[model samples]
Target: MKESVSHIQGVGPRAVEQLEVMGISTVEQLLEHFPFRYEDYAIRPIMEVQHDERVTVRGKVHSEPTLRYYGKNKARLTVRVLVDGLLVQAIFFNQGYLKNQIHLGDVITINGKFDRNRLMISGGTMKTSNQEVTGGLEPVYSVKGSIKITTLRKYIRQAFEQFGDQIGEILPHQLLSAYRLLNRRETLEQLHFPTDTVQLKQAKRRMIYEELLFFQLKMQMFRKLERQGEKGQQKRFNKEDLLVFMDKLPFELTGAQKQALKEILSDLTADHRMNRLLQGDVGSGKTIVAGIALYVNAKAGFQGALMVPTEILAEQHKASLKELLEPFGLRVELLSGSAKAKERREILGALKEGSVDVLIGTHALIQDGVDFHHLGLVITDEQHRFGVEQRRILRNKGLRPDVLFMTATPIPRTLAISVFGDMDVSIINEMPKGRKPVDTRWAKHDMLPRVIEFLKRELGKGHQAYVICPLIEESDKLDVQNAIDVHHQLTQVFPEFTVGLMHGRLSSDEKDCVMNEFAKNNVHILVSTTVVEVGVNVPNATVMVIYDAERFGLAQLHQLRGRVGRGQAQSYCILLADPKSDVGKERMQIMTDTNDGFELSERDLELRGPGEFFGSRQSGLPNFKVADIVEDFRVLEVARQDAAKLVNSEAFWKSNDYEKLRKKLEEQGVFQDQKLD
Candidate 1:
């Protein structure tokens, strides 16, 4: 199984290269390339098969299959076969090799989708004699360029025959019996070639359990190690001070906000260092909770720092923090890459001398020579935007400061527990009083005029609107709209109103200028990409028009729609999309059905899986090959419990049985830099 894929029969150089393109380099990798889906195509009578249904039929060809050419490189093969006294015709597109592979009087089985009176077996599995190619319950693997599912299946079968017994079991014998799971080798065998639905289900259960259990074990281990060391600062909060700060707010905090603040305040005074995650939906009043933490830290004679992703967000936080804390005589400062040299020097001096009670900035805060007098709390806004190493660099500036990570993207509770298992989580599920839900509408491309008129009406009412495009420039590959082209067309459509364009290609200074104009209402209609998905806040914006809305995931669409509806007036999110696929249309329907981010996130997971939920690079989701959080949630729960028990038990770590497991986890690199080792 450890041999190169080239060692397999029929896997020539071209085939090996194609297989490597799909990440199958070794025999083990080929075996682990599980099927994305399965179809039951056991041989059945052709007469009984319904139209438009897919089935497998066994019969003998009446005559040799012949190829007909339409062009130099285009051809089709047609074959007539007799199945249970019923005549059926099978057609294959661009497959001229069937002339040599299948002949007259050959007893072959073919799997295909049945049409009105023909079996259209385009790229179907074919087996000669009495042996079956796919057997029953055909497995369909993900394919790349020039690679067919049949080819993958053939190679995998050879691998199993050669190395099936060499596959070692990773799970403990006790667990195998306790969970009633098949051993590793048997599970692999059944998964690749299942005879019945029950066999497939059992094999899938074993694989899913193993994937989820390993991830849970790694995360729970991190959680256990976090509590073992590192004494945190004991910053006690004065009730009178908190009440005085609360009175200064223009609006009262909701019960949910108060509860989240209470939890944060409690963590600050605890002896253990606080590693907490604060999750809330867009416009759910998370800023105030973070503000309270900063104020409390300042009152305890420790300076605090808040790091944001963008410079505009840094300036916004500085302004808001100044307004909230300046009356109480707390000094606040902003540090950014664009800051003047003299201004930066002054701010750095203030930060080091403790005159700056609270400092807010982008990554500029972590620059060399920027020292803190007594940094006690570190608040990171939109935490997912920053990498693990970046967060560590900021935390290292202070002596084990209390870390509070905040994100507006609402993750499902089960996923949140598994991903951020190392940190204590506080969710603000409730919105502020008098907040109205955004009126959402899904429109087709033909309704562009109506959507345009609606935007005009909102603009006439003195409210601003936003227009988002998925792409920045026109490309030959994609047919979707681009920000540049959309900006030009929009300018022509609405000559009276100012239209602006913003995307990733623009410089930071240029983006800041464009966003500032939109925020000031200088540009009535802003055309942009996902750059505004996170930290841009404009209360006057009341209408959002997302071109090609089907291209975005549910959470992204929700976040874009959230840009509007922040003001008092009624807001509307007009989604202009006419997706041709059912999955795309279903995503659009989910967007229109609810304003709840968490609910939409779960639906997004179910529809597109976790890879799309959070992109592969930044997704906090465990990178499991077979485990799906939405479908295997029950297994995930069991794994979480088992992991917690193992991490807590003193004997498990000392036993030889878990030595290899521990080594594999160490080499995985996810836990390499953690304190657990």
Candidate 2:
């Protein structure tokens, strides 16, 4: 199965190069490259076929085949055939040589599109009727660079003939009997050239199950290796001291926040290293809970590191955390890429000398020169923004540190289980007390005047507002509003108030300055793109006006709506959009209907599918060849349970019953290390 493509019969140097272009270098890879679709060439009676329908009919040639030369390098062959006592003309394009092979009275099977009125079949392939028809389902490979479909099919057949026996079964016998799945070799054969629809379905089930089971097994192994031999720090902190720290806050802790903190505390005090994910909607007070955990770690005489995606968020966290923990003599410092050289040097020195209790930074925290004194706790904000390798680098800085991942994007439970199956999840669903859900409304473009009046009413109450646009600059392709144009229009509408414009094109320092002014209430109205969707916290903002709301996804609209409604005042989110498609209108209606991020995420997944849910890059979803995380969720659940049971069983790992599965996983580099991407 590992043999090169060149080893296959009829595959020479040119064929191997063409196969490699499609990412098929080995025989196993070639076999795994399943067809995207299939074509059925079953024989049908001419009277039963509809006009312009592709059909296959067996006919006897009645007229001699004639070849004609048309424009440059073009030729056509026409032959008359009798099917069901009705004469029909069969036309083949660019196959002039077929005239020599086809003759009068030759019984041939013609498969092509039939024109009933003209009694003609164009672009048809003819084969002798006496030859067996491999016609139930014909696999169609996505070809490129001079590779014909017939050539590809023939090469695949040759590959199976030469090395079919090497494709051994990877699933255990019990699983095979339990699931009623076909053996691996038979599964591949049926997938490539299925005899019937029933076999095709069964073969597909086997493949999907195998892919999902292996993936879940890899996740289970990763979880096992995370705590197999490592000993984590058992932090000791006084309960009275922790309660006193919480009581000093101006606002009381919500029940959900307390629960999440309790879970973190359990992981922190356990002997094994903790890998936990803290998920909550926007404005759920997740930061305060994380702050409490950091405080406990500091009291235990170990340093803590908090990493965010942007410098503005790091600064905001440093300010808030310092205010919360500094009174107890626990120091908090900020480190970012834009920090001055002297300040960076001093902070690094302090971090190494055990002076800084909590260090908050951006990607700069994972750089080479940054070292910690006794790092025991690590927290990454917006965990999806960093890749798996980046998180691993930070964790390697400490000896089995208890890691906590925080995200404002509330993932659905199904996706959470599939992607973060190895980590313990803590969700804070309850919003803090006194916080009211934002009043959502949808309006068309003609309602701009009324929307302006509403915005003026909110601003009249001395509250800030945010006007979001979809694009930063004008685009010739898109008909939506841009930030620059929207900024100009809003500045004219609200001449008395200060309107600040910000976008991705702005420098980091410029963005920070704009955000700082907005936070200080110096900027009355901020016009920006989606750059503010993540971590800009302004409590006094009361109204959010999004132009071209239909252009954004439901999850994104929800995030922008979260930018406001942070303060004690009643907040409103006005969606100014006139969607043309039903899906777009449904999205607008869904936004106005509920404020639950989890529900919105599920709907978004259903509307856009798993690939576009969180986007392919930041989604952290494994790219399975056969299984879909959304459609095959039930199969995934079953596979996850089975893999967990097998990993926990002592006999499965030690006995010969599972040696093939173990060796296959090792060959795929699953057991070589604990790294997961």
Candidate 3:
């Protein structure tokens, strides 16, 4: 019990507040805050320093050289040290206080993280010989605000020491014994301050493996528990509705769509609830496929629900879905946050009265008062947008409505399984008619004038353009482009042009109006932020200019670029960066090179790795121990095998040996009971 909850040592209300600010509470949570990466600050003898090969050197402070002021207090303290006939230069930064610590010719051993820059081995944060200095790799952790590195190391070390013996081991005794995993206490202790690099690797593996195993077990167990649920949505379609709709489609359905439609159609028509995820890259006809599912439910005289992340997207989906269902004499209603009070009241009344066949909205759909007549099919666009609670709320609305979650974010298979293993998946790998590729490029701030001129020409030709600024308001430290400021700047450039602005802070009505203007091409140069990412499909918009493109993740940049290229015109995406870094260059290259969203997504994961992409932003993925998605494909395969074995029968769920496992989940409030009756 103590392992789960925390009574942290020496932490009072004020310290707790600081830890809470960093999003940590319990002891378990604190333990999960692993090192970002290790920094190898191994103290090397002065003789080990090579002419060309770079290394860290430590020796006595033989002399304190004169501090020559190099403008703006940019002065370095250089000390000569005699050690094993290798002269070492101990370079120091802004260490006015260290001057007294190191008296003239005092015996001092300096330590710094050094690397070869040309012929110079640059140093950082070196320590004097007051404390016992040891040469070894150090761990770096992610921190918040101005917390000193020394402070963080101290706190982490304390946590490890105090709670080291109490970390309740969760890996089954038999499994651990078989796998030869180090005891939980030992692993945690070794990870914080490893005896050696080898031991550190071992600790990392044990922790990562535990995380992965726990999550995989979680997803599998949840699905197992869900399978026991006798409740499921009533079937709303037969051969009649599907044949009727498919025959009317303007083009022939690709085999992939046909398969996806079959998967979705069968799930809706079946008795068990459809907890399925539909994955396809951009330009794939996910909307149309979703429309088919909705239409099936509508034709069967049952209601459906489509939940989206934003009001603009909800409204757009409402229109698009309504248009698709219109020919069948079906009624589709929009119940977004922007709806006038009277109109919203009417919509709710209609929903409860079973008059609304298919209702589409944002989070408003999950309100307690909202009711559905016979909600048989539920679909969430960009499914990762909503949390588990939100999904549960909608499913609980009407007899376990068959849920079909859709995403244009094409995740890799290993990541896909780890992140969304609980959901039965369907792939829609095909795109629609005549979707032209958007030309992409990497650029600097200097390219902005040329980019603007080009967009000006396009706008002059009656082709609308989107000039996107990343930040909505000015940030004190970052000198990046802000939406309001850019709107002002663009207005000056194109005085007569209609420019619309939209961001998160706007009221629903204001956002709707701005988005509608941009969608209808009334706003020739829409100067807004990422608020338009999931909004309407503005085909006529030919240019997409993203300012400070480096600030965006590759996946997000792709999503932004996806807004344009919808129309037949040659769409162009201009990515603007300044003082380009490595990741910056990669993001720009991904945008300019390929329209394959799946490829771009894979590349993005490769660059940033699985942690940020499949981690906390979209929580509850089976965390890897040391198995990298790119590097550890084999381990994933093994985990997949184990998952299949565990979920295959009632034995695993009923076994007494698994009771401790169940209790652990219960303690974390992870595996909760969801009644479906």
Candidate 4:
């Protein structure tokens, strides 16, 4: 097996350049690079065009097309086509590039919605790629900036002509037989050019399974590496010390919180390092459990560190941890980029002098100058916010610190295991006692006054409010309703009260200033972008009114609402929804009917799909071809189990059986060369 191939067969340097634009490089990568969707462009007679069903109509241009410009940036090209005496107005919008592709009186088959008056096929989303597109079924690859589907089709067709035979089968014969999977060669050919929808679906499944298996194999291998050779001290939690602290809490811990705490305590007391992930819904008492863990590590004469994604969150952690642990005389210090010259001096001196028992801060804690006396444990908040390299930096701060990561967004258990197998997971699903489910409602633009009246009512009770918006400025299409505009309007309406605004455009310092004003209760309302998603805990804020709520993901809305309801007071979330989208209505409905973030997330996964869930940059999930995280979960599990089996073998690396798998992992940058002196 080769580590990497220079160029895919039959693809020229120019074609290779195009593939690289979409993040494809070598033959292995190209083979693994599956299509985003399979367009079943099977031919249907011109007379068999259904009202809603898509159809391809063969026609010849009756006249020269004319590019017509509509007002305010709306432009389209229109032409009449004659197919079997049925005249269909073929309209194309924002497709000025397509003008060059077509010639006057040219015969063509246009795949679009066939209507009596007009055919509305999106030339932008769909196009006629060469390689015949094989009317039975064909693969459609996604392209990046300037890389068209037509170019991708050409390169793929070239790939098939050249190296189609080089595609190797990685799955074992027994496993393939057990799963009743298609043969490797047949699956590839069918995926590139399928006979029917049934075969296309099967080919897709085979390919998705392979991609998932490769990912699972890599994760399982890393998990093995983490658990096998690492050793952790076994120190039981001091029950008397813990009970003394718990009894002093202003509010009692919930049953779920207690259970989660017990699991963390057990993990910490074990001989192996506590590599665990703590997940709970937003507003659940995940922080308190973390504080308890830090206290335990502190009592055992070892230091603890809690790292956060932002400085505001760090400040919140510092204040809360101080209040909870100050009675025990635990020396807690806050370190961040904004620390005063004298304050940072004191923190660094105390840290190096072995006086600081616990430390909380942002990425600044991972820097070289911040030394610990005896670092025993490390806790991370909003675990996914930090990247892999940043996590490694913090881990290298101490001598293999017991790492624990916490996430406020609840993920499905299968997803949890699949994504984070290196870490033991403990979930706190149930809410704490006496916590009220936020009263959620979906409103429209017409109900603005009603929502404002509700906000004013909350304010009359001396409660703060948060008005959320997705964008910072107004566009011609979307009414701005920006936080800036809202803030001005709000301040003018309620002149007696203070109003503060924040958005992504503001610097961290500016945001922090606005957030501080809101936290201090100086601002009656905080009009802002989604920047308030995971900041300080403001218990006084009881109302979250999100304008254009449909633009936000379900998990994000939950996070925004989490900004409120931190206190014992009842909270309300008013969502302004657009009537144009039914999917948006369903998304907002999931939030209004229930308070389960996990439930909302699964529904979100089903609705918006995985690409929107994981975000585009984080894992490039939306870019995957056939691997539907939701639909292909069975394949994910099977691949995970197979990966576990392979990693267990002492000679798995030596086996010729895994040569293709090994080469694939290497190609994925998972296998670094082991150089020996």
Best by TM-score: 4
Q: Can you list the residue pairs that collide in candidate 4?
A: none
Better of 3 and 4 by TM-score: 4
TM-score per candidate, chains pooled: 0.86, 0.87, 0.84, 0.89
Worst 10-residue stretch by lDDT in candidate 3? 113-122
Give a tens-digit lDDT track for model 2, residues 1-677. 99899999899999999998888999999898888766667887899999999888888999999999998899999999999999999999999988878878888988889999999999867788667677687887888888889888899999999999999988999999998999999999998989887998899899999998988888888888767866789898899998888778999888989899889999998888888999999999899999999999999989999999988889889989999999999999999898899999999999999999999999899999899999999999988889888888998898778999999998887677766777888988888888899999999999999999998988889999999999998998899999999899889999999999999999988998999999999999999998889988898999999999999989889999999888789999999999999999999999999998988888888887645665654544667766776778789889888999998999679988899999988987877754564
What's the candidate order when arranged by decreasing lDDT? 2, 1, 4, 3
lDDT of 3 at 122: 41
Q: Please give the distance, in angstroms, between residue 357's alpha carbon in candidate 3 and its true position after superposition.
A: 0.9
Best by lDDT: 2
Report the lDDT of model 1 for residue 345: 92
* Model 1 superposed RMSD (Cα): 4.1
The models' CA-based lDDT, in order, is 0.85, 0.89, 0.74, 0.77
Name the regions of candidate 2 deviating beyond 4 angstroms: 40-135, 143-146
Q: How far off is residue 604 in model 3, in Å?
A: 0.6
Indicate the TM-score of model 3: 0.84
Task: For model 2, name the residue pairs that clash.
Answer: none
What is residue 63's positional error in candidate 1, in angstroms? Answer: 7.5
**Residue pairs with backbone atoms closer than 3 Å in model 1 (clashes):** none
List the candidate 3 regions with Cα displacement exceeding 4 Å: 1-42, 45-56, 65-96, 118-127, 134-170, 177-180, 340-342, 443-449, 473-476, 614-616, 619-637, 649-663, 669-671, 674-677
Model 1 scores what on Cα lDDT? 0.85
Q: Write the per-residue lDDT of candidate 4 for residues 1-677, one digit (tens) a residue.
A: 12233444556667667667777776656665666666556656666676656676666777777887778687787767777777666777876666666666776667665554344443422343442546665567767877777666666666666777776787767668877899787787787667898887788778888778777777666666655566776665568987788788888888888888888888778777777889999878899899988999988888888999888889999999998888899999999899899999989999987899899998888888999888889898887788767777787677767889898887887877665655678888888778888889999889998887887788999999999987787766876477778888999888878988889989988988888888999998999998888757888999999998988888888888888887889999999987468888888888888888888778877887644566642442324567866667767777878888887876568877677777767766655421100
